[model samples]
Target: MRKSLISATAIMLFAAVIQSCNRKAETPMVHPDFETSYWIDIDLAEHPVRGYWRQVESLDPEEVSDSAGIANASRLLAEQYGANKLYVVYHRQFELDDARRIFIHWKTEGERNGLEIVPTVVLECYSEPSAMNFSDSTICDFASWCVENVNADEFGIYDVYIRQDEGSPQDTQMGILREAIGDKLVRIGLQPGEDLNSYCRSGVEDTWTAECQGLDNELWANPDSVDGTDLYGRKLLASWVAERADSAQSRRIVWNMIPVAWDYDKPVDDRGYVCPGDDALINDPPILGRIAKCHECIVEGYTDGMLTEKFGGYSCDLHILQANSAGHPDSISFYRQLRNGEPYTGYFASAMNQVSDLYKEIATFKQAKSKK
Candidate 1:
């Protein structure tokens, strides 16, 4: 509560003092050059529970394989409006020379696509069965594989994400990564609203949260930064101080918003697009509006970076949690995308008409629980 009040006051004072003369407006306005430059990390898995990328393929076997749909989805993201880069994470989907085969294939596709594709290789899912670990040999072996076989020089793994879900920080993991794939950017991802407190060994539980410990890499959400029931104030930036901080990574806020899916148990097409459920976010206006507002704040925050020249020193990557069972493009129904259910199979049936008929079934029959 105090932090929220303080933040509100600080931001208010910043405007009052920082711009006493040019204060023609009452509220903050985005600059003319303001543009969203943050990378949108999109996860492919729907039900990425235990053996998501490593062991099992999908919730069903008859539909789209996890490995095949990524390329098309990557292309779609590249072609979309608010997204310029795809920070994709492919742990172990295809049959790898254990993993080497699929890693190369993913990179090749990324390179061919010609977008800002940051392929991150996970080296820290030690708890989950079949997931990668952080052992000396394991770490060294993966690092060596990247440098030697994977070729860290090409469109290689630029960023490496470590998922320590159990809240146990591998204190030595950073040093080893630095020594080996130091050229590659390394950051740790923590599950928001969970046992992040355990990550902080120091008893300063007030401000030093598990999110703040990322120092370099901050919140990496599979679904979102905070759950729908939870407020943003309750999690992020609650325990951050600009001055009394150790390093640039720890000094400020950094988040990676990867809005795709949390428990994705749906069917997918040839494209990486997942067939959204009736309870999917696209159906609820209130939640969908919230998601839009969250992205709006993220864009505003990133644009604010233009104010400071030296703020670059702070290793900040504020993730706008654009998550939750990746948006159903075919069912872009609520917003002018919904259309007629009748099939115009006569001479008038055209390509455009067929496109509109995509989600006609849902519009004609399906009713969301919230809507009812």
Candidate 2:
């Protein structure tokens, strides 16, 4: 009987270990697609965890040396916005080889008046593309790494579309590109006589046409730097950032605002038309509107240069905005300090007090539970 009990106990322990592993793997992971520039949460149980990317430290206080221009942009933003308690969402680009990792192509066709027509094509899960050469240095591979390290639940991917210069969707190279990628895809049929020139530069119709079909899965479809009103572009970015609240701290919003200018010589379509200008700073005026609606608005600016320049750095254009609420009275006062460029000593002290009070409450609750 003693031996039997020992065997049963061991079985129980083994079962418990398996259960624990399953739980750990089930934890929700976050992902952000750079092509679409949106955030998504993926339940590991629901989807396979293929790869991930890491976020860059856009705002490191240590990087702000005394000699750096605007000496205290980091300190200033922190003082005004509660620096120690901010959330930094980091993500990297997709490497070409990683592109090979996920190759799911989908296709569908419909018959209209005795003619078959295809409407949509989708490339859902693609692995990073392999580097063309060993010397080829790209950021795409880092995206999967970032997703894994950041523990992201959702991510965005980009596909381009090319309508024929004058012919209908059937004549476009998109169909060929879809076939090249694989079979399972979501295709977007284009209207005849559509202006296809805007989709890409010379000798690149196949590339853009493939990306354009995967609009359903995207938050921002054709992201352009110059045209903020591009239906699937910047607006989608604003919405995606707002949706991923659980990843950030409680009562904090993370905004990924692109800068208002161009940073490279490449064609606009190649880089989602990232223009750095004030006109595109989201339609919300007073700047604090997004934060007021949500607990946090962490904006990711889209300028390519040292973040310290008055307009380039995050603190000046892409920093957090404090919101006023009856429950968060201290937050309102802290905003005032940041606006004045003063220190946030009181804000930090208030945070500590809240933490201490929470510990006491937990201790009391545990004691009460023990009595029961």
Residue 167 CA error for candidate 2 (Å)? 28
Relative to the unseen true structure, what is the C-alpha lDDT of residue 304 in candidate 2, on a scale of 0 to 100? Answer: 19
lDDT (Cα) of model 1: 0.33
Number of clashing pairs per prediction, in order: 13, 100
Error of 1 at 6 (Å): 56
Q: Candidate 1: which stretches are off by over 4 Å? A: 1-46, 49-68, 93-98, 124-135, 147-169, 188-254, 258-292, 295-372
Can you give the TM-score per candidate against the true fold? 0.43, 0.20
Residue 7 in model 1: shift from native, Å?
A: 51
| Model 2 regions more than 4 Å off | 32-332, 336-372
Q: Give the range of the ten consecutive residues with the poorest summed lDDT in model 1.
A: 201-210
- Model 2, 6-82: lDDT tens digits are 99999999999999878655432222111111111111011212222112222211111122212232344222332
Q: Which ten residues in a row have the lowest lDDT in candidate 2?
A: 104-113
**What TM-score does candidate 1 reach?**
0.43
Which structure among the candidates has the greatest TM-score?
1
lDDT for each candidate structure = 0.33, 0.26
